[model samples]
Target: MIQLYNVYKTYNNTPALVDISFIIKKGAFVFVTGPSGAGKSTLLKLLYRWENYDRGQVLVNGTNVGKIKFNRLWKLRRKIGVVFQDYKLLQRKTILENVAFVLEIVGADKKTIRFKAWEALKNVGLSHKKDAYPMELSGGEQQRVAIARALVNNPKILLADEPTGNLDPELASEILHLFEQANNEGTTVVFATHSQIILQEGNHAVITLKQGKIVDTRVVV
Candidate 1:
């Protein structure tokens, strides 16, 4: 469902991704693994269109991502979900509001928005926290809120960058299990992390980067 062809990206003339190319089929779970500064995060940004490539093409379901118009960017983003280590929830909004806000932007009616938001929160085991503000939650709980917000719209692809970096081992494992469930339910997952624990736990496709180049690609057995 996603393909890149001869992709190149640079920052101030320093290459962040060099001739990167890959194809991720629908319903596949892929791990993007690399050390610090290995360009793993950069690659995800390019795929998500947060960082536009300087050259070549990025195609998602056959549409060129790099060339998407700003007015239509929302169309592209609505099909993808992103989870971050920082748990970028709106600090002042209640958990339900935070997740429902995305649906609101998409113009869904109030009843449907509330239903989907609650369902997503329940999926991440955070339904009870819906009425609480973000500051009142623990780190793991906050991250779960973030995940719910991402999944509320039922995105086709989920991109997570260092999603478990700040949580404890138990919580990290829980988070991974949630991601596994999402993948099993047909959301193509691209998770980028340097966590050795994550590397060891998941048996799936792995794409390893080094110094802005893809050094290894592990096909699922």
Candidate 2:
């Protein structure tokens, strides 16, 4: 579903990504693992269109991402769900409202919005915290809410960047399991993290990077 060919991204003549190329098939779970400043986040930014590459092609679901206009990019974004390590929730918005925001933007009816938001929260095991503000919840809870917000619309691909960085081992494991469950349900999952705790699951394709280049890539059976 996602392909990058000879991709090169530079800023102020300094390289962030250099000649990176890879293909992620539909219904697959993959990792973009790398150390700090290794362009892992830069790679994700390109996928989310936060930044554009200076050279090469990026295709998502057969559409050239580089050619997608801003207006059209919004539509493409609707098909993707992103979870950041920080959770990126609105401090003032209640948990329920946070998840409902997506539905509201897409013109979903109030009843459907509420139902879908609640279902997503339940999936993340945060049903009872629906009325609480983001600051009221613990870090793990906030991350779960973030996951719910990302999944509420049932996006085709879920992109997570260091999703478990701030949580304890147990919570991180739970979050990984949630990603696994989403993958099992056919939502293509692409995760970028340096956390070895998750690699033990041994059910994904891992692309290891060092200093902005792919050093090793292994597809697990």
Candidate 3:
């Protein structure tokens, strides 16, 4: 679960998020939506502690995120997964290696890492490309690999920031289905997207923002 109370964030005296507040229940899937510069990305960053808010509180799974010591951030991040618009895959590493790197940093044994990494790729339907470098894959394939890497950790929460931004509608829909599958398996999902087609197709709760403030919260029917 995630909660934010009276949260405000500013960058160089400019507001990015103003008086934001909300609660996302455990295992729930929610969409954070807004146009460019509407603070959707900022909000996700706050949840994962990638960026600290200038004021207010953020709690994730009962931990006071703002109060966590920098040295201990791994404890908080270990339970969360993030996928970006740009599939931030390691170019020099094979797709399998890119996913295994996450487990490596988390200190999993080599045997466990190999199994989990392979399973994750298989989940994303990319196991056939396990030995391929990122540059060799298509855009959708690259994004699938990123998703595999993100989920390999079995994270409690998944934060996807405009993850389908670059893809065509067909590819985007495929990517969205992957997120839905993860949500169905019980990982809390907070997907930030600006695509109206995506918003209209889902029945999940949506938090809309504009000019750094929450403008609407509704569950699409």
Candidate 4:
């Protein structure tokens, strides 16, 4: 679960998040939506502690995120998975290796790494392309690989920032389905997207933002 209370963040004295507060319960799927520079990405970064907040509190899974020590960030990050608009895959590494890289960073044994990496790729329906590099795959395939990498560790929370921004509608739908599947399996999902089609197609709770403030929170049917 995630909770934010009066969270305020500013960059160069310019507000990025203003008086933000929300609670995302376990096993919930929520969408964060807004126009460009609306602070959707900034909010996600705060959850993961990738960016520090100037004021207020952010609690993720009962841990005070803002108070965590820098060297201990991996402890917090290991419980969460994040995906970006860009695939962020290593161009030089094979798909399997990219997923396995996460496990390696977590210090998993070699055998476990191989098995989990393979299973993750299979979950994304990309096991057959495990040997391919990022450049060798299509845009959707690359994004699927990115999702596989994000899920390989079986994170408690999944944060996706505009993951469908670059793909066509059909491919975006497929990617969204994968997120839904993860949510069904009990991963709390917070997906940030600006696509109206995506918002209209979902029945999940939505949090709308503008100019760094929350404007609406409701279920889109």
Model 4, range 49-134, lDDT digits (tens) per residue? 99989888999999999999999999999999999999899998999999999999999999999999999999999999899999
lDDT, candidate 2, 10-58, per-residue tens: 8898888888899999989998898888988899889979899999999
TM-score of 3: 0.98
lDDT-superior candidate, 2 or 3: 3
lDDT of 1 at 42: 86
Candidate 2 stretches greater than 4 Å from native: none
In candidate 1, what are the lDDT values of residues 130-162, reduced to their tens digit?
Answer: 899999999999989888888888899999999
Error of 3 at 50 (Å): 0.9
TM-score of each: 0.98, 0.98, 0.98, 0.98
lDDT of 3 by residue, 100-130 (tens): 9999999999999999999999999999989
lDDT of candidates 1 onward, in order: 0.91, 0.91, 0.95, 0.96
Q: What TM-score should be assigned to candidate 4? A: 0.98
Worst 10 residues of 3 by lDDT: 196-205
